[model samples]
Target: MATVENRQVVLERYIEGVPKVTDMAMKIGKIELKAPKGSGAFLVKNLYLSCDPYMRGRMRDFHGSYIPPFVPSQPIEGFGVGKVLDSDNPDFKPGDFISGITGWEEYSLIHNTSQLRKIQPDDAIPLSYHLGLLGMPGFTAYVGFYEICSPKKGEYVFVSAASGAVGQLVGQLAKLHGCYAVGSAGSRQKVDLLKNKLGFDEAFNYKEEADLDAALKRYFPEGIDIYFDNVGGEILDAALLNMRIHGRIAVCGMVSLHSISDPKGIHNLYCVVPKRIKMQGFLQSDYLDKFPEFLEHVTKNFKEGKIVYIEDMNDGLESGPAAFVGLFSGQNIGKQVICVARD
Candidate 1:
């Protein structure tokens, strides 16, 4: 097969503070469509790319994190949904759709297939969902709420960044488990969705609150039994003060602090000691064994209309940079994804 041009979203340089679309450049590159013999790799035509809050951590020059920093002048890598075009592995075939770590480009020559999952296309489930609802974000929510928070029936649950990919599901799960669920979002539109669409017991616009602690108190008059912290800092500090005795807190991503070079600490953390709050920070990768269970559970509830997922999609790979940058500012309504190509 003749080599073809692959348009890639490459990191222009290592950046500090909030990321801008300018930090990445769209460069046209070339690749062979065929996977080399005995290489055990597959070649895929990228379809959808995920723009997650966690990717912000990879834009730096740090090396200590679980995932390495994105190489400057190279394609920014993230979870993607793709169709297999060529393969040298027995598990995958030429027509199989896959979801895993893929380059943010038109096509990818994937050598590492460790995290890859063979996607069986369904007319009911949108292909892009593998990058969001059934993807890392959704899995993260399951692990955090069920494993980390250890939620219970009749508990008072709160989720910050409530309209985001992970938070939206966390709030819904809390409600489904017979808990009083409240969520805080950045805008009124999102807050409305939390109440009217996502089925949260109550939703608030955190940006409109004069005092976050007071806002949480208004919503959770009995104190919170579980607090799923997605965006850290101020909201976390507020939730700390509102936690009930023996409450549990799941420290998910600190999307609020990701852009900060020197982030401020929560002053109310001392409340954790007095409240006996079980606070834990976690990564979804820690619970890979539960993936089959997670998939089965979410898929069933989703199909029955007991659960719903929301997404904000950007068409074309050229829109990748702006779509990613939009995540930090609450510009996206739900799961932010870039549609690279249509299958």
Candidate 2:
């Protein structure tokens, strides 16, 4: 068999307000498909890469973000699961499955083998689940809900962008915990996905609602105790006014604010002080030490058929750029995955 060279998706420029196709470029490049001897590195055949809203932040030149911006003309990387083609690293061997930060390319020479996790085959979940339900987004939802929000049974919980990757899981987790969960999305079909498929108690289409505050009030008649915020700007402002005393807010991502400069500011700052509401922003990496516990919890729910997940897939590495841009526009029905090269 002929040795395969990698095809990588590279960032062409740092985005300003919103990303465009012109900011990214995918092209072929040469890479060793096999791991070199005694290098403590492994070679992986990239199968799936997650498309996340947080990646949009990395596209811009931002200070105080979780990581530095993706340099121009460099291969973009994100969470992915891959099959080991060869391993000079003792922890992983050829044919082993793994997940972590991998390049948006056909293959990768991963030097920091310790950073990559070896996916256990004994676990009855699909390997791809490691990138979504069993991965960062899932952990984000779990930690945000349990640690950040700290809900009581029968308390009202609200999730914005609830049909998207992290939002869907947050709604389901809240339901599992006995909280009344409501979600908002951009489309009627997504609202259906939340209420019908994901088991959210109620869902509203933001596009159809003339007033976001009225919509939140209508659903959360008693005021919300916990709010898992995914879309910020106006939604956050609306949620702030509707929060109960001692309410908690977990700031996940702000997809609504990502596309615009001078985003709509919240006018209800007084509510936070009087209500004693706690609002916090968290990164998934901050909870990395708890991943094993999260995997155990989310996996059990999956096995017991207590959870439902949906994915919108785009085929091939070439489609990656457009698929990522679609996240900001709420084009994806569920979690977005770019199928770089199928195993």
Candidate 3:
């Protein structure tokens, strides 16, 4: 069989802090179209790759994380949508469309089919939505709000990093559940997007606020019933001080602490005792069984114009490094995606 050139984004070394484009190097390699014999693997042409905050953890050296860290000199992997080219696995046939953990490369040979999901494309939905709304980020929001937080109607809801991928969906879902929602973003544009476009009850640019606690108080005079904590650090401490009795806090991401060598501890956690708050951390993979229901619910809302998803798309595999780096710098307005190819 003829081999094809594969351009891949490889981790140059174990990163210590926030990942930069220089930490990853693009290389041109070659791959056989066919999966290795008896490898129980499948070959795929990557279409779209997702750039997420959690990927920063993978850039570090392996240290007993829930997911294994990416090895230096190897292709970095993340959630992506792709078209199957060749398969040694019976369940995945040639021409099948799948989405899951894939390398930042033109072509990838996926050995584990367990995480792979077959995509049933619909004209009503964009294929890239699978990497954002209908994919992990959307599912993360759904599970965190509904399952973990157990939100109620008319409650005050707050979302940190509100304009990003997961935060955007969480705010919308809170509104759909009849809650008063407020979101915090890094910039004025994202704040406007949260309030004007995504239907949040209120939104603010955290960077412009001198005191985050004051900002939260301004938005939630009655106190927050459910806080979707995305940024963590000072924001979380502020939310801690502002949480109502029996408030629920769903810890999603700590982007602020990801690059910091010495992470700050949350000091106001003592309030969780007197307030009887339920604060929990979660991974979306914990709620895989709920994906089907989540997909149906989100897809319906999306088609009905009840939910809106924004994406910051970069073109080609070569753009993967910069796109991934942008997540930490808050350069992406919404979901950061790299368009590897169009199927």
Candidate 2 structure quality by residue, lDDT tens digits, 147-264: 8888899999999999888999999999999999999999999998888999999999999999989999899999999999997788889999999999999998864355582355
lDDT tens per residue, model 3, 105-141:
9999999877879999899998999999999998999
Residue 286 miss distance in model 3 (angstroms): 1.1
Off by over 4 Å in 1: 259-263
Scored against the true structure, residue 298 in model 3 reaches a CA lDDT of 97
Quote the lDDT for 209 in model 2. Answer: 90
Better of 1 and 2 by TM-score: 1
Question: Which of 1 and 2 is ahead in lDDT?
Answer: 1
lDDT of 1 by residue, 141-214 (tens): 99999999888899999999898999999988888899999999999999999999999999999989999899
- The count of residue-pair clashes in candidate 2 stands at 0
Model 1 scores a TM of 0.98
User: In candidate 2, how many Å is residue 97 off?
Assistant: 0.6
Q: Model 2: residues >4 Å from true position, as ranges? A: 122-124, 255-262
User: Superposing every Cα of model 2 onto the true structure, what RMSD results?
Assistant: 1.7
Worst 10 residues of 1 by lDDT: 255-264
* Residue 262 local lDDT, model 1: 27
Most TM-score-accurate candidate: 1
Using TM-score as the measure, what is the rank order of every candidate, best first? 1, 3, 2
Pairs in clash, predicted candidate 2: none
**Model 3: colliding residue pairs:** none
